[model samples]
Each structure stands twice: as structure tokens, then as C-alpha cells.
Target: MNVLSENNSITETAILVNPNLGHPRFLEIDQKLKKKKFQTCLLFISDKRDPAYIRDYLNDRIKIVPILDYKWQSQLLLERERKEKKGFLTKVKHFFKRKKKQISELLSQKKIEKTQRRLESLKSRVYRGSPIFPSILEVRSVLTHSIHDLEYINNEYCIPQDYLIKNHAFETLDVFYEIKIEFTLADELLDLFRIRNFIMFDIVQEKNGITERINYHSLVVSKNNWHDFTFVQATDLHLAQRNDRIYGIIKEWMDTFKIENLELIEEAYKKDQKTKKREEQAELFKLPLKRRFVNPNNQFRIFIKLMNRKVFRNELEFVVLSGDLIDFTLLSKLPKDIKKYVDFDYDFSNWKIFKKIVLNFPQKKRRGVIKGEELLCPIFTILGNHDYRPYHYDIRWAGLYRKLGLKLEEALAVNDKLLALPISAIVKSKRALRAYWSQVNPLNDFSIKLGNNNFIFLNTGSDSFKNFLDLITGHPSLTGLTTKQIIYLQNLASHKIQQKKENSFLFLHGPPINPKGKRSFLKRLSKKISGKIITKLDEFKESVIKKIGIKKDTRIDGKFNVKTGTVSTNWSSLIEFCKNYCNLTLAGHTHSLKEFRLDDPKGLKTRVFNAPPFSLKKVENPAAVYYDVYSEIYTSAKDIEKAGPFVVQTPALGLGGYRNPDLAGAYREIVIKEDKLDSFKVKFIDR
Candidate 1:
């Protein structure tokens, strides 16, 4: 049946039940809903977008209901505040005690005045209107409360009402809501046996007076006899806006920077001098430097177009975005001239760009157009390292400082201090936490069920900047699975086991098992000279590689080296759980394609092989390449069953990790037939 909210004009009217709900299976449901009255809940997250606007837009066609009542939410907030006030005295006492210790340390280091000056400057920059010390203390208290609120919402069952109430919380809550739509399921809707997409719409009026009707897509499985389906796994999109401040900063830096008589440049100069080639010398001086950054918005748009083509052809079921959805949470408003770096303005432009790209908004704009090309299927996403970054770091700064004979820490002391602040401290300042909860999934970790298969998503925390060494070398412990996450996984595994699910797949942002490649003799010598120590575990791994007569770097593509603490914590336990329950595990962080099969549940033996390459030819007008890469690498479905339970890592879909453009826009296609593993192959957007 066709539903009209206001006018009968097709431009504004949407078919309440349409065959083009993104997936073929949805067509079956659409047919079933011809005249029936079955109710299904549509869930979505909203931040600044008002629920009333949605209700008004949908009119009487759907019932818009808040998950939590406003009065109840207010009562909950008041009760929470009352409890916080009760412990205020105790907290103040502890705060003063810590202040005393900090002051003493500063005095001993002879940096008391410097610390005081920094605090005063920060106060002026952050809270210009308020009294200095009081404002600083208030900011600290607010940050602490934000952390408490996030923990409470994440751990408890209450709906986050902070997003709904103005000034109720320090950061946006990104409250979740549900709507019930009545439709009938006809026999035609029941014919398809695969994932189906349910698309819903909401309208938001922007500050610029632009009216945006956003579509939120969810997946459902309708009744059918078929046992075949396909889905795509793409990761590390690193989506960012073209006008994002990071890009401008990098561009300005690149344009002004020059190498001073480097070997290659020197050789070219000498050649030009020998040949008296004035034109060549001038051209050498004007060499166009390649940019280190690529506009991920463009890459993502191409990816969406490719996926949409597959969806239209009824060849794809759904898509799984395995994290790093955007490059960073916020962009820095650093000026073109690096001399005056006093005040920085951070904004949610990147998050906004992600939303726009996903929804395919502003249909007329072609710069980052994905509006008419939004994914035709539903997508499930989790958090990754870059998604958790609140601050922007220009890597070029490190090189610039090095050339100037200045320590990066010393040169960017203020930036370092700002970056060093934990995520809890900057929750209010950064919009990443808010934007993610509001636009994407509210919970970092969640699960979805399709037929007899269960898919579990987990968040692997964020990047660490605890110390200077951590800033440079990076720390694995910072982004490893937390105790709570591990417990959650354990509970989920138990539930799936009890339900006797046919297949359970685990998705996470960080790889539990990642080994370094074998280093050359000179590299080993340099490391040894630099005081690097090889643990006993490394020695054992090397010995095992030699004994097994496998390549030295086989361990790189093999199994987990638990003792290395790569996952930081619960390494052994996570491996055990995956082996016992999970049929497949997919991760993204390394930004390179890798596959490993574990035959023993105890993780004693593993099989690793190089993946097959994509086809070289472009065949049709809708030209593309396809590879039976999984079968080529691991033989067949029977082998996968006998020695399987594989762990795979797909390459990034946006920027290439190794500066190879070909590696960008990578994704994995998984097929399941007859309730068994059919094929998992790698594909790329030829464009």
C-alpha cells in the first residue's frame, strides 16, 4: 500500500511497502505486507534532531515514541545529581589532597611558575568570562561528571536522556528511540530467504535553513525456504570532509616545506648543472610534492556506488563496516601560519561529513556526492582506533621539529598536554563520543541475529598517549579489550552456545594476533644496538618456525603470540573463547588482507596462506573484477569445515596503509549456502 503524509505528489511521498528496500529478501516482506497489519519497531538514534519534527513529518502513518519518558528521565537525572552532591565533600577533600601533591612535585621540579602560567593561559583560552581558578575547577568537575554519565549509561539499562534535555549533560547523549509501523506480510514477501532492509525517514532542519530528510536503514530476515545469502565486509574508511582543518594544515605545511640538498635532489641538481639544463633545474625546484593525505570522502563515495550496483542487481544482502568509520572525532582550527598556535577551535565537521556521506544528503553537491548513491543495504559498524581520536595531530610536525633540532614534545608542549588528557577529560570538548552515539550505534558493542547466525561486535578501546614513548611508539595495551568487554563476550558466547546457533561470527576493530615481519640482519643489529630486547617467547617462536620448516615470517600470518601481550589483556582468554565458540573472526586495524585457520581449539596448530589476486580485466559497461580468492587460498568449503574456524583481516576501504592506491577501497565478500560456509573472497572498486 502507498502511504502519504501530506500530498499525493510522488516527490514527497514514500511507498510504505516497496520492493526496493535495498535487499531482495525485503521484496518478499513487501509483498506479504500488501494489506496485512503486522507491527515492527524501527529504532534510531537522535542528537540535535528533534523527535517532534520526525513525528510531524511522518504524520499519522507511524507512531513515534520515546524509549524513556521525559518525566522519568528528569527524575533519574535529579536522583543522580542528589547522589553526586551527597559525596561532594569527600570528593573535594580528595581533590585538594591531589592538588597538594601536584604542587609539591611542581615545586621540586622548579616548574611551579611555569605550571601556574600554563593554567592561567588555559583558563583564559577555555573560560574567558569566568574567574580563573573557579572556572578551571568547574571544567574539571564537569569532565569528571561526563565520564561518570558515560559509564552509567553504558553499564546500566537506562536510555540516555541527556541528548534530549538541553544542558542536562556535558556531552550529547545521542538518545535512542523507537517507532512502530503497521504493515501486512503477503505471501510474496515470504518467498525470499535472505537479509532484508527496512528503510525509515526522519526530517531535520539545519541551522543553515536546509531541510534534510534522512533515511535510516535497518536489516530484518523474512520467512523463506532459501539457505543462501551474501554480505560484504569493509573497514577503516577513515572518512573525512574535504574542508576539514587537518587537510588545510597539511596542505599549507607541504607547500612551504623544502628539502635542503638531499641525495636525490643533489643528484638532480648536479645533473642539471652538468647539462646546463635551466628548464630542468627550474622544474626540479617546482616539483609537485605528492600529498600524504587522500580525500577519504571520495573513496567512500565510490565504494557506496559499487555496493549500490550490487544491491540493485540483487547480488548482495548487507554490509558490515568493521570500524574506523572516520579519521578523527574532531578537526583542529589551527591557522595556516604555524607561529601563532594559541587558541584552537575543534568542531564536529568530520562526523557531520560522515553522516552526510552515509545519508547521501545535499543531492546536488558533487564534491562528496553519495546522496543519490547511499548504500542500498543496511550496515553494521563498530568503533576503531582512529574513531576514538579526539585531537588532530599533524605528523608533519614531527619531521619539521626533527629538522629544526627540536624535540617534538618540547616544541609542541601545549599540544602535547592537550593530547595527553584522557578521553574522559575531553568528552565535552570533542564531539566524537556524541556524534557516534547520536548518528551511529549508541552502544559501542552490540549483537544482531539473522536466521540461525549470530554476529557480535566489540569495541577495542582507543589510542593511548600516556607518555612521550607511547606518543611515538604507540601502545597496544591502550586499545586492547577491557575487562568489561571480555565479560560481555563471554556472556554472549554462552548465550549463543545455549541457543545452538548454526554460526557465530565475531567482529572487532583490533586484531588479537598480529606479528611483525622478519627483520633483515642490519635491522636486527640496529635494534640490538638501540637496546631492544627479544623475549623468550620470541625465541620460542623463531625456534618453532625453524623446526616446522616454515618461512620465518609465517608467524606473522599464522596465530596469536599470546605472551607478547599484543592484545595487552585477556589475550589467552579471548583466544580460548573464539576457538570454543566463534566460527569466524574478522578484524581490521592492520589495513592489510590476511587469513588464518586454526584447526585445534587449543590454538596449537594454524594454517596460513597468501590470498589470491583480483582479476586484471574489466569486462562490461558495469565493468568489475571478481576472484574466488578464498577457495584459491584455502582449497574448498570442505577443507574450511575440517580445518577452519578462520580469522581474517580485510584491507582498508579508504586510504592505503602502504601508500599504494590499489589497496584502497578494499572489501571482502562472504557467501553462505545450504547453512554452510560457501565462499569468502576479496574484491575492490575498480575505480
Candidate 2:
């Protein structure tokens, strides 16, 4: 089928297609969509799952084609090439090529010195028992291959350029093909799907190798008449494949070297133990290694079940996952030499786990029916600081120490440098970006208009590594709001204002206004002196903290209190936009339920208020009264009403704020009735 057309204004819906699920192609799609100027409900063909769900949003607007017997010719060819056997001559040629590259890397004096400095820096950080350092050969090997290995593992999914260009299946702006079906959905689907956002499709050929199946899902646009709806806002779902106790054990060892290599040492000691008492002591060390942390993977599954129940009852419209959707960008591969006590793969990444848990897969027919635990509603996701992490700190550190014979401190130093790589470095490598674009949403910043309400999503960006101080003190100001993002928000806000939109809500990863109490007098003075030379600390403090009178003060720990100007860049502009345009601004990096009403529109003053904990039970029932819950905590309706035009930080839904179990698995339920903001309540998974 060949469908080609110029830019035309159609329905407010756009489809993003990524046939081969390549990162570079996805990036190209992102660039092309930005130039598009139209209001649209973006329908992305995320995976190979049958997008019958697309029918729910796109009601008879375009013709539905049932593709059958279609094969992914390019993918098949790629598989064959990957499986092709190399001859002796070819193997010899490849071996020489690799040796030449390694020799070249080792010969560079600049590279050798840089590697030695890094190794020395790592050695300096270790203060434990007589530590074993890498040999000169090992150091040279690291210099020659570590970065290459890291980059290769990260970009493992990138398709070859030759195959990508040759594939007739590749389509982005204007669809072109010469398949049996020679019709274009472009003109018909354009008006209804005319959206400005980037869309990526996962089009898989059907079994008979003659047809194509377009797996897609549509978004609710202005054309939809339903004004009243309820949506859930969940954040910081640090999802991983498994909650390995090895990570926790490594963390314990790193904090105090007294427990260094306890597991491996115990295993070695067990064989030599003759005394019963010695065996018991070895078993004691084993206990801690076997002790697992709270499984984020399980928690997310439970959350999906709850959401499914809500959808079954017709109580929810959609879900907005603010950020921290995964613990790290890529899952760590446990050293194969290590004993496996768990049932699953040690190297199962979150992206694979996410697909298995969240999306539907082709299933064997039972009584002519297929089944899977696919979420019943659309979900929009953004990236968080954790999502930008390339590797797990604990796993990588453990690998360097145990497998590579690096000292515990040396391993820690090496891993720290890797973790501190900037956001640009992470995204450019394309591992995290690949998982995100393929499994989650494509655009980092986007806006959707549903009826009279406007929902804007922005990416606050990865962990701030502005300088050495940022790495040490963990300054929140390094969390970015790029100039482009600020401009995007400005444009969206301006458009909303021009359209006379009744209600507007802003969703971002980092909160713009986070206030904390003063530090110790000595510490404060030291920080002041250091700030002059290194970082400029935001000294903005709230004068009316006691006056606000928040009842249930959950921020008992001081860790959640990030300073005012430290949370994000373009702080003043974001605040101004929220105050003047948005009715509510929701964020979740702090991982705790905190709300602050922007009291002073011109300055950084906010009135803190306690949001009453509302449960899913109360939400399930339509007639359930919230007055009692509200009145019990708040003095009057006016006090509750004052929360309008507010900034609310929802608690994390996966990992806890201070690793507190009770504080985790929390989400917010937002209700919009008759095009007006109603209730924004924090709810927990168990409740």
C-alpha cells in the first residue's frame, strides 16, 4: 500500500510509527514532528500487541484494515545476517582489526595518563583492608575497552544504517509502500489524528506474510464531549526486573567496609569450616545476603491490578505517570560466576520486565480467545533523574570489586564517575532513550487538550552534574529546565490563554518550589564560604511556614526539603507560568505528599497545606462524600478552596523517599467535574 500526501490539516490526531524499534529512527521522528503545527490526539504503535484498543478512542473516523500474512522482510534479513557464519579468512581479518584498535588505544600517551589518573583517583577513595588494585595490563585493558563496552551494551538495539535505508517498511512523515493494499490512511486519518507531537509505531507483519498489522492507540482530544472525568497521577515507579538482595548487601558493604566481600568470603570459608560454631558464623553472613528489599516490580503489578479494577468499574479515564518509571536506564548483568539463588535471569532489564508486565503479548488461543493483563486505559509517562542512570551503582560496583579484583573503594570511585555522566551523554548513547521511546511516550515535553482542560507535561531532565559540588552536595538546582522547554511551555500557556481554556494543569518531574529549614550554624557558615567559590546556593526561605498550619507533617526527615532555587533551572519562569496560567502544578521528585499554594504571584512565597489522605475505596463509589474527610483536617471550605492554583508533590509509587516501606506505593487521584478542578487526594496502593 502506498499512501503519500503533503502536510494537510485533518482531525486532531497523529500516529507515530517505528517499525523496527530503532533508537536513531525514533530520534529522527522526534525531530520531524516538532515542525508540525496542529492540535492532535497522538496514537502511537508502541509494540506488537494488537491495538484493538485504538478503536476505543478512534470511533469509526478512519477505515480499519485487517492485515494478514505480512512478514517483516527487513527484520528477517537482519536476523539472517546476525546468524551468518564467518569464514577463517574473515575471522582472521576481524581479529586483526580488533587488535589494531586496541594497540592504537594503548599507544596514546594522553589516553594512558588519563586512565592512570582515574585508576589512582579510585585507589585514593578506598580506606579498607589491604586492597587489591588492577595491574598495569588490566589498567591498559580498561583504557582500551571499558568505554567501548559500555557504549556497545547501551546501543545494542540500534539497527544498521544499510538495512534501515533499504527497508521499504520505513515510513515517517508521508507513508510510502508497494504492498498489496494500495490505499492511503493519510488523508482519512490526518484530520482526526492531526497532532503536533511525535508518534512512533510498532507495525508487525501478519503471519501469512502478505498483510500488515498496525498496533495503535488514540488519545482523547477536544472532539470528545465528555466533560467530567477522573484520572490517576502516579510517580516514581522505580520498576526493576527483580529486587536482588545482592544490591542491598553491596550497599551495606560500601557504607562500612567492615562487611566487605562478606558473601564471597563466607562461601569460601564454608568449605574450610570444620567447627560447628564456624559454620554458624558463616550462615549469619549468608542471612543478610539473602534478605531482599521491597520488590518494586511486584508493587507495580499490584498497582496495575488496582487500576484495572477501577477501569472495570468505569471510575477512571487515564493515568499520568509523572516520572522515575524505572530504577535505572539499563539493568545490571550479575557476574555469571556468582551463584544464582533466584529463579529469574540476573540481567533482566526493566524494559523487558515492563513489557511483560504492562503490555499484552500474542497468546495461544483458549476456546478461540486470547488473554493478557493489559491496562484498560491510556498512560502518559515522562523521564526522571533515575531513568537517566545508565547502570546500577551497586551491581556495577560489586562487579568491579569481585570480578575485576578492584578494591571496594576503587570500585566505588569508578562507578561514581560513570553515574555522574551528564544527561546529554546518557541520551546520546540511546539505551535509555530507546527503552523510553519504544515502551513509553516519545516526546519529553508535550501538551494535550481534552475538552476545556489543558494538560501539559515537561521533562525536568536527569540528575544535575553541573560541577564537583553538585556531585558532592547533591544540589537540586542541577535538575534542568532547558530554554527550549521554557519556550514550549510559554507557547502552550499562550495558546491556552488565547483559547480561553477553563482549567490548565502542569506536570513535571521536579518541583519548582521546595523549601527547607536552615542548617546548623557552623555548617551554614561553611556552606556560605564554599558557595562563593563553587556553587551559588539559593537562600530563599519561606517566612510563613508556621503560619500555613499543615496538620499531618510527613516530612519528619530533612532529606525531602530541597532549597527554593535549587530544585530546577528557569525557576522563576516556571513559577510565573504556573501562577498566571495553570490551575494546578503537579510534581513528584521529592517522593512525598506535599502541597503548596502559590500565595504571592510576583515572588517565591507559598502557603503550605496538608492534603487529606483519600483512599481508592472512597474513589470507587461515586456518591461517597469527601466533605467529612476535608472538614476534619481543614477549618473551612474556603481553606480548601485556597488550594486552587497550587503546586502538589505526589509520593513515589515504587521506592520510598527515605527507603521507608510505609511511604512507598503512593499515588494521587485527581477529579475534574464539569470542566472544573475538584479533588486532588493522595492514595496508597495497599489502601
Candidate 3:
């Protein structure tokens, strides 16, 4: 049963094995045909219910058949099923029912915040084409920022008194001005407030796409906000799920001969294994990556080299991890109680190892939590569904907070300082992120005042999910809606603006979509909400009324008059949010990493950053987005090889889902000073 080969090429007949379903006849056939001529490409096809076992042992002929598809009968069956479906109403009802099922999910957010979101559908329907907003809202202030001046300026973004009143609601207002505004990222700001119910107002008059920037503004903001930052860090860790044993064998062969040429090396390996019929059978066959992803622990010497470095020694202020920490849970059919069946103790070993490093006190090179006065900060744990959550499972914030909001100051405060914010990340837990956010109670008002600057941190998922859920359900607002109302979830917006002399930085995290002129209405709503906060909520109205060097015929207050302005049918809500104060925006979740530089003609620039995940490639659940992601956390996985007891040497690349219960993946550090970035960095020991 032990077949180990080194760098050998396969070129004969490939014998298919079925140890699980018991194939004694196939084994006999394999034994008899060991010395056959042509190569046999192994074909594994089995019915789920009853396997039609067959093996022609008496007269076997070898021939090459290209596997153009995975199956034939299944495709036919599916086509037949589709053709035999129902009528128009039946299909429509079915679709609505399915969306309703998806929306029935319970939210994982603060009770108050949750309640605010429940009313979103009606809010969106009632307010989509107007400047007037609801009464129970708090507004974020404008950052008299253009891309060229905010980074090094000493201005603070606050809620204008006219906009936000403690515990009071407000509506959207029209604003227009001839001031210099710059390009910006909308996803980043809406993410900052985790805004629930809001609307986007494309102040400009034109047709644009998601990538195109329209100079408009948002009139409302998220009520719940983060504090002047205590400095939160974001970083992504990438990890491989599994490795193939065959690949290991290939690696051994390549290592033995140092084979670099793809063609000649494959030929030589095949020739060397000429006598080994099994090896010859698999010639030129491409193997599945899942089976060949053996963890690179065999290369421990390289890990040692990375561990003894200075960058690994610095402790952090706060850590907000993105997904893909470890591939603990890889669920398929229904999940299993992982810890009950597997040896997960090994998973926590690496966390314990790193914690010791962070805590060390007496040692010159601190190990665990170093006691440096105000240094060793608390770590915030968020879960990727790939970690332990899916097995013990619940819904998450990622599914929530789609795209818009208000509350400029609070949003900026949270984006600048994650730990000081009251939003939840998509960490899986039986208790939910909202429960944790309320329990953590990051700050009294979630605002921190530094010497001259402020920082804030917030994310979507919560508010967006709530409204989306309502929209999905036949709530009053969703009773007679199309897909449009279902997706926007009231509305979502995002923006990032930095003040130079004030030493302030802001970031907002939401589902990632670019500035392609805001194709999706939800995306436009998100951008508009963020833009309104950056510019004064009422400036456009003032400009229109006075017409001080302004156009006489702009849309305003619903009716088209030779007067002010109105909601441009083609303008997106997101572009409406970015018309002012362009700043740095960092976000994750859309599985995209991108950047945007927006500045006035004056050289002001706002940066956008996207954090990547480190989970395994998903292969199951092909009904939807047919790619694989580590699905669940497992205690003991027969198919997966465990590692934590070993070292993970890759720097930015490592598993994201948690294998160890003791700690999450990498920890992020936030460093702040008065002159430059009130920023943080995510770090992991090279090992």
C-alpha cells in the first residue's frame, strides 16, 4: 500500500482505485493489466445512489479519451428538469420566495441599530427621489477638503449643528457649490459607519459609471459612529488549503534532477518509470491542486530565518483581522462538530507560541505581551465563516451593510480607530457581532480626541444586512418591489478624507465596488451618503438659491424649474458622496484589491486600500458563486493535513480561518503620531 516515488514521470495505463465503495474486480483488472501497452487515463464516475460497477478483465483495450466535460447524463437530466418547470407566476413566486428565505436570517447587530434598519425598505421607497430625509437622523460634517489640502491640514470633520441633534431625526437637503472637490472612494466611507438607512444624491447632472467620478454629495449619515481612533490595524494573511501527495512525488523527482524544463523533465520522469506500470498510466495528466497542497513545513529552515527579525518584534495597538486565518472548518453536506472528532489542540499551539512572544517582559526580545506602559493593546477577534463559525454557525455582517449611510464625524472616528468603534466584523460566533459590539462598548460616544486630530473605524454588513433582510421579506416597503429595492437596503455610502495639520485619517469598509460611475443603485446610495458628509449638507441648496455664479436651470425639490437642482436620474448615490474631501480609504470583502487616487487640480490625493483573504479555495456549493472557499472549521479533518504545531513561514500568505481556538491569525498594529499617519499595520512573524 506504500507507493513512494521520486520525481518520476507517468506514461502508461492509469488504474482507478475505489477503496471506499469496494472494487475488488477493478483491483483484479489492474493486476492483470500491469504490463499493458498504451496508457490508461483513470476515469472515476460513480452514481450517488447506486454505482454501476464494471471492469472488462477478459478483453481490455487501452485508448485515450479526452474528458471534455465532467459528465453527460447529469447535464441531460438538468436540461430536462429545466424544460419541465412551471409558468410565469410560478417562477416569479419561486424567486421571491427564495429571496425571502435568504432575508429571514436574524441580524447580528445592536438592538437599536437593528430596529433602525427594519424600517429601511419604506424609507428607500419614500425618499429615493427627494432631498428631504427622515426626522430621526444624525448628520456627519463636511471636510472642507479637496484632494490636495486635507492630508496636511488642521481641520476636524464634525457634525454640523444644523444637521445632527442629539437623539433627533433629520432629512436630506440639496447642496451645490463651485468649490474644488476631488476624486474619492465610496466603499471606504460607508464601511466606516456601518450605516443602515440612508440615500445618495448625485448633485451633478450627467450619466456616469462606477469608475467615473461625479461631483455630487450625500445629505444624511449613519447615526452610530466610531471614536477618535485609538489606532486600528488591517492586514490580510494568505494560506494554502491542501497539497497533493502526487505533487510531492513530482517535487521529489524534480529535486533529484533539478528539472527546470517542463517538457524534457516530464519525458525523462515517464521514461524512468517505464517499468512501473502504475506510474506510466498517469502520464501528462494534470492533477488537482487540492490534493497537492502539502504544507511547506518541510522547509522549516526558511521559517527560522524569518523569525529572527526586527519587524517581528514590534507590538501593536489594535488588530482587526481580515478572513483566511486558518482553514479549520471545511464543511460540505451538513457540518460536523469538529472539536468532538478532531485533535484541534495542535491548532492553538502556534497562537500560544506567538502570544508568548508578544507577552514577554523580562526578555530583551519580548515574547508574549510585553509590558511597555501603554503598549500591549487588546486584540479584537473577527471570524471568517471558514474558521469555527460555519460548523457551529450563524449569519454574519459581511452579508449585511451593503452600501450607504450618514454621521460624518462618527463614521470618520470609527474608520480612524477600529477598536474605538461600535461596529462588528464578519467574525462567526453563536453570540453574533452585535452582541459583542454592545458588550465591548468600545467608547462612551465612540469618539476620541487626540492632541489635534481624530480617527474613526466602522464597517457595513450590520445595517445593510438588516435592511436587506427586510427588503427580502415582504415587509411593507418590499411588498411590491423588484430587485432594485432588495439590493440597496435603504442606501449605503462611503468616503475617506485626511486632514494634514490636524493629523487625522479616516477609512470606511464596505463591499468593494469601484468608481465606475456607480452602476448599482445601492452603490450609488452609498457614495452619495458619504459625499454629503464631506461637503456641507445644505451648501448645494444655498448655492442654488443665491445663483452666485451658478446655473439657472438645475433640478431641485422634485419639479424641474429654472431655479435650483433635483435628483439626477442618472447620477449614482456613491458619486454623490465623493464630491468633496477625498481621503485614504481601506476596505476588504469584495475579494478585490484596488486603489484610487483622487485630488483636486491642486494635487490633493485620497488613497484606497483593499485587504485580501487567506482562506482555502472552495470546491463545494456550486449552485451560487461556483468557486470554493474554506467552508467550515474542523477539529479533525482526514482529508486535511494539520499544521499549527509546525511553523507557517510565509509573511503575508497564511491560512485565514482559525485552526486554533486559542488565538485568531495575525495581529495588526496601529501607530499614531501628530505629524503623519494615524495608521496601523497588520503583522505576523515570518515563521
TM-score top scorer: 1
RMSD of each: 23.3, 23.6, 33.7
lDDT tens digits, residue span 614-644, model 3: 2222211101000011112212322112211
Q: What root-mean-square deviation over C-alphas does model 2 reach?
A: 23.6
Angstrom error at residue 159, model 2:
23
Where model 3 places Cα greater than 4 Å from the true spot, the runs are: 1-232, 237-389, 392-450, 462-501, 507-512, 515-582, 590-592, 599-674, 678-687
**How many residue pairs in model 3 have overlapping backbones?**
138
- Residue-pair clashes per candidate, as listed? 9, 24, 138
lDDT of 3 at 210: 16
- Give the candidate order by descending TM-score: 1, 2, 3
The TM-score between candidate 2 and the true structure equals 0.51
What local distance difference test score does each model get?
0.46, 0.44, 0.23
> Which portions of model 2 show Cα errors greater than 4 Å?
1-226, 244-292, 334-349, 360-372, 395-431, 467-471, 474-479, 498-501, 517-568, 601-641
Candidate 2 CA-lDDT value: 0.44
50 Cα displacement, candidate 3 (Å): 66
lDDT of 3 at 149: 35
